[model samples]
Target chain A: MTARLGPLFEACGAQHRAALIGYLPAGYPTVDGSRALLQAMLDGGCDLVEVGVPYSDPVLDGPTIQAAAEAALRGGVRLRDVLSVVESIAAAGGRAVVMTYWNPVHRYGVDAFARDLAAAGGLGVITPDLIPDEAQDWLIAAQKHDLDRIFLVAPSSTDQRLASTAAATCGFLYASSLMGVTGARDVVSSTAAELVGRAREYAPGLPIGVGLGVRNSAQAAEVASFADAVIVGSAFVTAAGAGTSGVRALAADLATGVRRPAPQPA
Target chain B: MVGIQPVESSTAVPDARGHFGRYGGRFVPEALIKALDQLTEVYTEARSDPEFTARLNGLLADYTGRPSPITEVPRLSEHAGGALIVLKREDLNHTGSHKINNVLGQALLTQRMGKPRVIAETGAGQHGVATATACALLGLQCVVYMGEVDTERQALNVARMRLLGAEVIPVKTGSRTLKDAINEALRDWVTNVDTTHYLLGTVAGPHPFPVMVRDFHRVIGLEARAQMLARYGRLPDAVAACVGGGSNAIGIFHPFIDDPSVRLVGFEAAGDGVDTGRHAATLFAGEPGMLHGALSYLLQDSDGQTIETHSISAGLDYPGVGPEHSWLKDTGRAEYRPITDAQAMDAFQLLSRTEGIIPAIESAHAVAGALTLGAELGPGALLLVNLSGRGDKDVDTAVKWFDLLEDK
Candidate 1:
């Protein structure tokens, strides 16, 4: 089983920057091509990698990710194949985790999936659909397998909800600044800084990462100014259309964005 | 292994956490939880309020046409080997289907929630039209997401929705089917939840939805049971309905679950056949998996991806069913069987010819099942089938299938 992701976040803290996290679907474009994409994210300076397990019905995702997932499914990606990508991500020295909707993992046997993910050296899982309210089976399995169970909080979260959600999370908290699905937007919402501020009150010790529309470096810098980590998803998927080099180049740019100094308050 | 036995208990299921014996729960993104909790809270309060109950019952009685008649099919009984066949005529309801019952209740809930707009996803467009009907009467803006393929197949319904002042968006993603439409609707809900009420169209979906939608449609079984007792003096030998998302099936089946003498049979749509891997017979062939916010029997590939489903009846072309149906199947309280397109179409034609009742293809699946079941039960057995909808919305598809329209 792989250890928790605590040390990696601590290292990023010491470096005085929000960690650069990049996301890509496993078995997208093609089986081998996806492996190249993961390597590119790490090579291009992503501090951590979130390998998405493409699901058939992704309600929380927009068109781009859904198209990529559909293509991945057409290419016959399986749960076992996804684990191999996670294994490669860990072996390449980048922090590794998986992002998937809950059903596939539950169908694979919750305990068995956690055990397998740990064996693959993946640190944790980001479940978009499996909220803390209905995570009893998952919580037990995660504990037994020594895996982190990261939960998400949106801008819509109430204070009580924020506290409860933060209390249940094991690794860093994933805070989607927007209430909408994943996609590249023209401008980032300003609500994220406030959401992160509330989360900081509820979970001061845990690192908080923001996602759900971090497309370019400017948006990345804006988010990183307050957040502990900057997570990019659908934008990276769009870049992968130009192949692995496109992904590497974008990852490098976002990494630089995370390192850029915050604009001072007036 | 724990020895499997039929759990003969109360039909009152989907407890507070919305679990129908581990089959139903809130499997949704965090952003939707607050709204779900609020819905649960509001629905619970409404249920206990006399004014709310009275007003909704009043709408069901007057506007939606409640206590739909029990029509006997004497000529149709000949095909069932002289066995008696009667129907709960939900086909006679306002908007021509049982779908009106749930939509009216949800539309009322939407008004209560102070949401000015409603969004829904539909397959055959029965629920979409029904939602549009309710929204028009109640003065709420309506938008329905339908699969691109279904919108083309059931074009009249799209026109009907548009005429009723609802915007119909054709979803072009994920095999262009009902499940894809649901995904699109959820995305809309995630983004515009504050101003919009989802008004989910079936007995399937996350937490309170399976329970809430079922309660709304429970009137079908409740009234049918009473009507049968008052008119016929006995319960049915068997009660049958088609299972799509299992809304209409569970609606009628729920009232009869405690009656052990009554056999509950839900017929699923088997397009070519279940063996052909082109069918929507989830309980017959699928494994336990979560899809569309509930853990139920879903037709999925080995890797747990939902597979595309095929059925002559667009209403029954869904990969997943209500979670309560999963519990009923697991507990042996109800049995599900598959009826192929040919059998359903044959029954559809027979009912039209023999009884002058043009049933929906979805309901035709149930009629086909009743014919086989009546033969097995023999001469004196009483069978009650819930004719879920009228065939008006299906005329175009039927015209193509039967080649009735002339090219002259």
Candidate 2:
């Protein structure tokens, strides 16, 4: 079954636009501060909010997100705090999901983490480092709890891997725009559209979310022109340093970018 | 996911997907799966290919000064209750450590993959030097990531790597040690997978790394076992080595795994003490957790955050041990113990004065443990220890620690 995300993407598809997805660390800056910032993002028209759990060794993240996460961890951000943030997002009438490396959830007991996340009003989890091959227990848990299992596909992924990943994923397939860690680049990856096309060819029914290096509205528009979802992470995390209004402002700008009509195929 | 048999034995460990009883498996990003698969395939094919084996064996003989001899430390053995203490002299290798064994093999693999650039992460700089050495010999571009703290702690080895034409990038993230360096190297691999091959130094990391690295260094055990049999007419009662990411220890332990009569002992670094919350003794005190692309024993907090680790020896100052080591510990096939800095230092000094051979601080941890094991085993019991690296790069730290360099 698809994530409750179907309606969100359906609404965007009706507008001939891509859904805007925003990412924020659950306890960044401060616990309550993150909730307020996510609230602002939702208010600013983000269709979906990804509540990131800060980890000690975030090998997948870029400098901005890594530094922010280190600060949050130093401030004693816990998993419960992440749940509380997701709860706040749900309480504020917003769609939410939790994204983190696999260890914390595995250490907490996979089934228990899934149950708690479901209870906390989170729809699913995005495990950047967890592929479908090594996600046996997590997959079982996500299924038992009716939670969406979102997996990523990279440009380097073989057709076999793309097909398998698309088959395993329930939510939108997270297509890494480039062969790099999480960070914003000067331009949206030139290979993103091509990768998204491959993903569409493989999945067919699944929505594709292009992420990594989509910082500004123009970049978002570029991604939205081809994919079903425009995912922005480092940009929002960097903007959070400027405070909630800044986050909301950027979210609104990005929200507008996703609604831009796709350029007619030549 | 493909199952790999540990070399020289029918041992069925780390089933496909690389799980050694839930300890070793790939826990990395999907972005790296293809490269890892490609590496696994190349390494798998290279193992049985006559030409590949001949090339690697040839380098080991000529380039790395292969079949590193076993030295009987008679004078030092007296301090250990007169036990027959034999040391496999990996320290005499060209790069001064057993790290060259795996580095050379992987460097060959890089050539096979047609990847011109090689990236590595180092703790004590032994592995960095070895990687750089192999890169130089093969004319490959090399970049080494070392913790900022270690570049100063191991300044001489840093210079050696530079002299070999390897770019050294000092990582300043997370505890600023080996763990962070690995993270940085993994990031670099993700960014440049097509152009670069991450020459993982130790037996840790994702899948094939643990088994592949173990296979490359398996020669240590294979050779030492034969030496023990030919010279002493029997296998030693025990084999001992320092456990950091467990490459050296596993190198000397693999062939002996099925030898029920022989004991396999690993000494993990205990900085101040295990109870002091500052030690790098993962097998001694850590719980099972995922770190650096594999499920293994790691020093992590209640929330599953990797605990910052410390050790007087930079090489042993890691929060995680190799997954196979974790499997060995769990299966009761091997035993691991904590060795404190003070004890390791005492052993370091003892080896220097008595045997006229100074060991790398990492190897000294094993020496310290060996003394205790020797005393327990008593006289006449044979103990084979892996003297993993030489002390040349550590002389500065030694002078400062022992106050050997006076104003004169």
What TM-score goes with each of the models? Answer: 0.97, 0.98
Write the residue-wise lDDT of candidate 1 on B1-408 in tens digits. Answer: 011112233766878889999799988999998899888999888877777788888888888778799999999999997789999999999988999988988888898999999999999999999999999999999999999999998898899999999999999998898999999999999999999999998999997999888888888888888888887899999999999999999889887889999999999999999999999999999999999999899999877889899999989999999999999999998999999999999999999999999999999999999999999999999999999999988888889889998999
Native contacts conserved, per model? 0.85, 0.78
- Pairs that clash in candidate 2: none
Q: Candidate 2 on B21-58: residue-level lDDT in tens?
A: 98989899999999999999999888888788888888
Candidate 1 residue B190 C-alpha distance from true site, Å: 0.4
lDDT measured at residue B80 in model 1 versus the true structure, 0 to 100: 98
Best by lDDT: 2
Q: What DockQ do you compute for every candidate structure?
A: 0.86, 0.86
